[model samples]
Target: MELTLPKKLNASQPITLETKGLVVIGVNGAGKSSFGKCLLDQYGSLAKKISGIHALFINNNVEEPISEEENEFSRLQSMITERLFMPRLSEYEKLILHLQSEEFEAAVNYKEACKVNPDLLPPVTKIDRIQSIWEKIFPHNRLVRKSGFIELASGSRDSDSYKAERMSDGEKLVFYLIGAVLCTPLNSLLIIEEPETLLHNSIKNLLWDEIEAMRPDCTYVYLTHDIDFAASRPDSKRIWIRSYDADTRIWDYELIESNESFPEEVYMEILGSRKPILFIEGTDTNSIDSRLYPLIFPDYMVKPMGGCQKVIETTKAFGQLKDFHNLESKGIVDRDRRTQGEITYLREQHIFVPNVAEVENLLMLEEVIKTVAHRLMKDPENVFNQVKENVIKLFEKDLESQVILHAKHLVRKKLETTVDRKITTVEQLAEHVEGIQQNIHVQDIYTNIKNEFSLYVETGDYKNILRVYNQKGMLPQSRLCNICGISNKESYLNLIISILKENKEDADAIRSAIKESLGI
Candidate 1:
């Protein structure tokens, strides 16, 4: 029968396959496999004869199957010839030979014996047809490897063989991928309903590997509803089908581009806290985004909102609070005469493309630039660079202020000099400040962290503390000095613990210091 891809899409079917991979998605009865069968008939190598045995008919118990098909084929011939015309014995034997898989040769023979006046001769016509198709698909000389090695790949869930008769729907689907990849037919197509069904993540990778290997000759098309796997592809092309009316028999397809829609807001809220996000448009970004942000952006999150929708959400929820930053999107550049209102609005708000108009986060500052182009090009390193630079600026500003304060103190003590005394006074002030800095020893911080850690143990917030520690290994991975954000491991709290253990300082010292500091 002839089949064609209808101009009006019937339901989940590929209109085209411009890339190595294609996804056809819809609910059941969408005809996901029909497209595949059409391609198979057109491009798949034709056999002089084409057919396959249903596994239920194969007798693997005897270590062979030909023993059965041949017997069946021969018996049919005898029945046809009884007081009737006996066809060519060659045709009967040839048909029986069609069932001769090397492993099932015994069954093939058995089936052959059941027939009378069998046609044992085989024809090369079907073989020639297959060769013609293979000529286009296979190289001039496909490699001939020595056989007799057991080479079964790790089985997918579908390949599990509890029993052939009791196979599940999911298992049967997986069986197609397994058989198609293993068959290595030069020209064919493997069409499956849902590749994601019953597939574990680890084995899912194996299925894709098989698909890629078959791409040189075979074309695969499967339907899926897996938004998690679906959204991972930055440039995924989807044939989106929707119910046109309350009850329509037909499903139409549209080419969905990456720029069309956006991820939902809930995902932005959750993933926004954990990792930076790259803002793309989509429906299901949050739950999946939160799950993958840390894996993708280990350093800084590329938030999809970029304070666009997030800023708006913040404004709506916390407009009463003084700290709330408003969502200000810079729509487009005003080409003609600009006004003060436009300039003021532009100056106060982050300039983002107007396509995105959702708000999520209500906490952080919204630093808007005129365009999304600059932000999209930034790497994770650029984020860290900003942090490091800001930290240096903070420290330098504090350090210079402290030096000025010390210089003013010297001036009060009558150390003011018109010439060389300025330089000498600066040096003396630095020396005094250095002496005070050395007085803060870890024996102090450790005694301090010990008290704090002990209190944490009492309050049961220690579980939360342990969680933070586990997140970063204590050895060479910790950030804080276990006291302040200083040297926690080696010199500060670490050294104090060592000294106190050796010196046997009373733990009461911490309480005493605390009480004195409290002026109790």
Candidate 2:
């Protein structure tokens, strides 16, 4: 279970491959395959010391290459049949005789019996272990048990059986993996690379299910760059490898099981398009990153990172990935009470933090509100003031919740620094009640937070608040939602989108600002 490679390995700490699976991911040439090979070699040498330590390395390279002359179905079938029967070549005629007789069936039955239950008596019969596994992996594909051999029948085939060479790459790989698993020793390690190469999502799931059914019986070490696949296997142990020199070699590696920290290739794939990537925060329906940025900056691929920190990390990560070094990547995050110093530093890093409180705050503009009312066939003069009043009132009601959340965050931050250093023991927990009391002064924090929000909520001053919010940028959240109390039937953004019909000048102004941000 413990593998120690050469000093030059530059590998991470010794990895323990127990019942828990391991996923190895890195960029191309980042030592993924090399790491796997090194482990396999080490595993082979320690086979005697490590009990039940057989290993199977599965590269996605197709073993059976379709020959140029073997274009015909019969030719391909003959080539495959010859390869399958190669091991029994000495008993070729005898084996064929037995295959024609009932003895071959008896031998296969005994093999199945041993697979199903190793505790069964000698010369066992009446078992269907492989059949059961095959069913789980490819339920629709027919497994034809002919007198001569076992073959997989495609559902679309006109004949009774399918030529092995005729199957799709995915089908072939599944067949290869299942066959390899069946033949491997119990408690062996199965190393698979690039499982997503040709397999569809559904087939990949089925293949994984069959592998999982193997359980503690056989361990799996998957080398994959596919994020969705890794996300599906949450219980598995994950090791992310990184290199400094364009994946020429490994520089560092760490055990990062968190999906949030997943170094997915999709990032490079987007940047690989050679287009500017506008990385932004938020992934939900209400997010401007997901909903509106694409329309505004049509030239750039607007990627939605899970949060502000993720966007920052990803933007930096792109610089490290040398292949994508030329990519013009920019990130934008909400202005969440950041200090002037922090805001200045972030802008210098090409990461924009809008002047407004958030995207939502910038959208609460009088002109934008009037546009929405006009689109809805209401008198703009009559409804503008009402909408403005409602937005201001909503902010006032939301102020307490916001203050409470911020205070809680600060308290937790203070507690984290205070707890372990001063009050470590369980016995001191009761005596340290004063620590919590001293750190959390909710009333004082609430007063300051209320005063800060007062400028934004005061009546007749909403337009001025928007003006100040948009000081650095023009209509920063013009495409964002304004009204907070939107219903299931219609969102505030949807209303604004409708309003764009009556306000061509406003739409043009917003688009111009967006283009300026993109440097288009």
Candidate 3:
């Protein structure tokens, strides 16, 4: 089934949805609810809209009317009101009746089959199916039949059972959702608004997967503002609602196509933001780049792209789309063991390679150390000297390994270029192999790297050492925390982050120092 969007959303030709699942996502006021309502209206009786704010009040004592017409009308009225009170209670009663009827039918069939086949297995009832699914979702809790009503049981004893109506809001929501879907007619379109509502992150995907598995005939339409939830359904067609014009009753929306080079979540996020993009290397939240880059570059929408290569690729991809998006893009990556030539090349591509080896090393910068020391009422000069001495002592002890690692990086980088060259003939391929072997002088490379590294160690140059050192635990090893009167590395990092957040002067000082060191 295809439902064309409102004509105003697309003047030339409105976008149409497929029978397969589709996720409609946007910010809070971007007409996601309106879009779902439109689809429900278009599809009419074939589509059922489940409100994000669906009523969770399930009263087992409520009785259905004797007249079928009255019951149907009541259900219609409740749906029109987004399933609030009377309809929800009536629906629960109907579900129980349906389950009871299925149970009776299964028993009758089993009795008849027993005479012919004593070993015949009994068919699973609707209640049994629900119980099985509930157990998987909530292993600690069990659903039990008590006094002709479904009750929640915490233990094996009957005394542990409680009325289903008394279940927590989240539990009630899950029960209502499962019952509604199972009760829905075959081949119906299920329009679920904010499906992630009241659902824990760990189980949101699992719940939807189980529901979809149970109802393979139904097409799911999830309307949500949660990008993470929207991205979770990789198979679903994604439509981003950009804006809604209340006066014109028109929406500004577009279908988001998959891009192999750019991630769907990152793309959706960038599309929603108005600021320039800053792709940094780290995980989305926990890493140092994620925590620190935003405070330093507040003008840009800082997105962590995990690794240095991804940061470079994403930045370049965004740059290519700049004409259409009207947004500038750049990337920041660790210095690592990149040589001056490599740094210069990356800088020309608008990818900023920092002076520090990695984001962790940023905390050990001279300016950052001094600023942190001053914040703790310690003498900046004395504290920094101690940090420098400790770092140099550590580097001297591990000098051979550090030099070898740097040489290996340079050799690998060089070989990458050589191996990428095209060779059309066997002679050329043989020549290429021989050239690589002849050019790669391990001892000479090691000697050069050692000499370069020794200069920093000999002069006790803390900044340059930070640029060359790839050790992640160097801060703790250097005992910078002790020198600055902080408790530990975590506390020191938190203090720096707090200073960046609350103290503008120190934040600027640190940012300026980093930018100057990086020459960005």
Pick by lDDT: 1 or 2, better one: 2
Better of 1 and 3 by TM-score: 3
Off by over 4 Å in 1: 1-5, 9-20, 27-100, 103-176, 231-237, 244-250, 259-520
Please state the error at residue 514 of candidate 1 in Å: 41
Predicted structure 1, TM vs. truth? 0.31
Number of the top lDDT candidate: 3
Candidate 3 runs further than 4 Å off: 8-11, 57-129, 146-148, 155-160, 269-277, 284-287, 298-302, 318-329, 385-402, 424-427, 437-462, 471-479
- Candidate 1 per-residue C-alpha lDDT over 273-368 given as tens digits, one digit per residue, 9 for 90 to 100: 433223422235443223322232234443434333443343223222212112221211211112234335543432222211111100000121
RMSD of each: 21.8, 10.6, 6.3
lDDT of 2 by residue, 152-243 (tens): 67545565785444655555455545544544566666666676666778767666766667545666677777766765665677666553
Least well predicted 10-residue stretch by lDDT in candidate 3? 52-61
Model 2 TM-score? 0.50
lDDT of each: 0.35, 0.57, 0.81
Candidate order, lDDT descending: 3, 2, 1
Q: All candidates' TM-scores?
A: 0.31, 0.50, 0.79
